[model samples]
Target: MRLFFPLLLSILIFSCTTKQKDHFEADIIIYGGTSAGITAAVQAKKMGKSVIVVSPDRHLGGLSSGGLGFTDTGNKAVIGGLAREFYHRLYLHYEQDSAWKWQKREEYGNKGQGTPAIDGENRTMWIFEPHAAERVFEDFVKENQLEIHRNEWLDREGGVVKENGEITSFRTLSGKIYRGKVFIDATYEGDLMAAAGVSYHVGREGNSMYDETWNGVQVGVYQHRHYFRDSISAYKIPGDPSSGLLPEISPNPPGKNGDGDKLLQAYNFRMALSRNPDNRVPFAKPANYDPARYELLARVYAAGWNQTFEKYDPIPNLKTDTNNHGPFSTDYIGKNYDYPEASYERRTEIINEHEDYQKGLMYFLSNDPQVPEDVRKEMANYGLAKDEFTDNDNWPHQIYVREARRMIGAYVMTEHDVLGAKAVPQPVGMGSYSLDSHNTQRFVTPGGFVQNEGDIGVHPKQPYSISYGTLVPKKEECSNLLVPVCVSSSHTAFGSIRMEPVFMILGQSAAAAASLAIDEGIAVQDLDYEKLRKVLLEEKQVLEN
Candidate 1:
């Protein structure tokens, strides 16, 4: 009977050894085509590692090419490695006369908008147009000859194949399999990290959870010009309680200050607009357009709020990277709470709803009689750029998913790290931006007035080192996976680290460690810090100030 059991065990082991090996294999597999994903792939190739990018979105750069040309670059000096190279390439592209199609380079250069587009001394342009940014990402792929598959959604249901705590392979919705020695979850959603059973948090953590003063729901903390300056009614009719709440105002009681909640901050499309009449697409009314949806906006305008063009930041040519400004502007608050964990189908529905809402808001601003004549006239001057985003009817393909699922990794960065109060061991990058978060919810105040809550911007005293531990999963959880975009950090710290430039920095650092791990045949978490730090410094990554 013992000999019979031994024979059965031998047959089971034999079956496992003969499993199929014919699949798309690489030294490293990246799951998203975000700016971080592209940069990670570039660094992997530079390290002579075979890499593949499995992207859900067709486009390469996420928000970098998706109308956020007015970059949130805090201190440009800290941006090094491939992240700085990207901006330098943009400068090279703009040096050519043909790059400026709508406006002359000379005229655009002297605008003195936010940051100079043509930095002659450093040869790096901080601001650029949407197409210009996309062109640079495409150039990187062509220059590196990296393999990329687009529109390939991960099969979240049993797609991640892990054997004895280490992921061996993963399948996409197309039934294609990808095998790699290491993987990077560079998506804003952190889909791959969650699929591998890694611990993560979606909503804001309680301030007490991390001893952070800026982590949780903030009600009266108004930092930007986005709060209501004048008291406005929250009812459909001026002062009627039974008339019910306005369209976007939430009725639920906002949680206590410094307390945690499952709600996420709002999201919006950073519209790439143009004042050039020859290269503009006028705002069109969307299907099922509702003017009543923007009744709050009209009330704000009636209360003498006319700062619609405050954040229409100028990019190259006559285009502007328009962002959310003033109370009840482009941010569609309290509508995307389920986005972090939503299924593919449900996420699409939420994105479509945001598109419709933004489209309707633009149409109302340009055509509605409720908007003041002066405000409407100024809004009409700017329209969607005709030459940009030509594939999706000139609308941006990527929505600004400001914050999403953050992994609880080997190290969790908090406000202490960002404020330089805590030591950052094994540094990989730097983030200098303020801890900024948009309004999470629009609610009726107890004073019977409409107000927006949850916008806070607290700057760090100086640039701080971002630890390498934030990019890696716990040793016992998933050893081979590295998360750069949705890194391990407290909500307060992530607000500063969530910038695109910082993502590229971490992505390159993640790839460097991945390549070293592959060379030593060790897990990413098990790699020695000195060895990885040596490679990063050699690649010109600024570790500390």
Candidate 2:
């Protein structure tokens, strides 16, 4: 009986070995296709590592391809590695006559407004069209033979399995799994990091958490021209709550500043707009459009507001990547509070609500009788770009999920980091954008006027060093994970780190870590900084100075 039991155990062990060998394996698996994801994949290939980028996006580049073809690059000189290479490639594309499908090369000029399109020489471009940016990422992947699995969501629960402080494997909702030596959570949401059991944070921290003045809500602060016009009525028409709070206003209480809460930043679709009648699909009345919903905007207009439709400027091909312009603009604030961690079904509902609100705003301004005639007539001249986002009813499938779950790694970057309080020793890259935060909560002020809090735009004292440690998980946490796009940082710190070009820089650095970890067969946390720094410099990652 003992001999027979031993034989059965041996047979079971052999079967398990066979099953384990068949699981999908790669040197690195990136879990998002934002600009950061694409850069990480390319860097992995440069190091001769087999890689797969499993992206939830049907498209590759995140906002860089979505609608912000106009890149928000603060210090253009600091951009290096794959991020700079991307803009150089964009320049080469534009240098060709055929690349200008709509506008003449001379007509293009410098179109980034205040932001520089070219450096000392006209060899690099900082901004471009949406399709061109996507093409650049696609071209890079094709050249490198990097495998990309589009429209795949990482299963949050049990999707990632770690063994002895290293990520062993991660599975997707489609049942496909990927086993990698090292992994990067390049998604803006930091989903992979969370799934791997790493600690993270969300929403604003108090002023004391990081000694940041702009960490929490600041009501009645009108930084941008996006408030109600005097002619427009109040939330309750100066008295009537029975008339009820405005449509987009939240029912929940607006929490105090310097208080920790789970309020999410406002989100909006980057609309591709055009004036060409042949290509424009005139702003149609959304199916669920309601005129009364825009009562806040109506109040603004009644106050002689006229700053609408000012953001529909030109991109390549005579198209314009229209962003949110002013007060009560396309940004659907206070409606997406539950979205950061909501289920997929709930996320869809929130997205639909935003779409309805934004579309209805456009429709009301263009067609409703309540809008000023000049505003309506002017809005009537614009529509969604017919060629852009054709499959999803002229709407971007990915909403501008501005901020989400940020991993709390070993080092917590504060406003002091950007302010140059302490020099980061393991410098990977640099970010110079202001510690900017959009509105978080809207509330009735002591004076009875509705106002937004948590919109800060304080400039950084200098271009500060961003540490490589910020991108890596702690030694105690999962060691093989490198998070570039959503690296560990405080809320105020993330405000600066969240920029696209900065994300790309971090992506390159993360990939560098992955390659080094593989060569040494060590955890990502313990990689030799000397070797990593040498490789980054050779590849132009800009470690220091």
User: How many backbone clashes does every candidate have?
Assistant: 0, 9
lDDT, candidate 1, 26-78, per-residue tens? 99999999999999999999999999999999998999999999889888889
**Which sections of candidate 2 miss by over 4 Å?**
1-22, 116-120, 228-233
The TM-score that candidate 2 achieves is: 0.92
RMSD to truth, every model: 5.0, 3.9
lDDT of 2 at 29: 90
lDDT of 1: 0.91
Residue 49 of model 2 has an lDDT of 92
The digit string of per-residue lDDT tens for model 2 on 1-545 reads: 99999999999999888667535789999999999999999999999999999998899889888887667777777888999999999888877888776667666556674665644384787767777888999999899998999988988988888888888998888877889889989997788898888888877777777777767666655566555434333456655655667666665666665766777678888887766666678878888777887877777777777777677766766677787766677888788887767777798898898888888887888887778998877776678877777787767666788888888886778888887778787888889888877777666654456666667677877687888889887889988899987678888888888889999999988998899999998988888888988988888876654
What does candidate 1 score on TM?
0.95
Number of the top-ranking candidate, with TM-score as the measure: 1
TM-scores for candidates 1 onward, in order: 0.95, 0.92
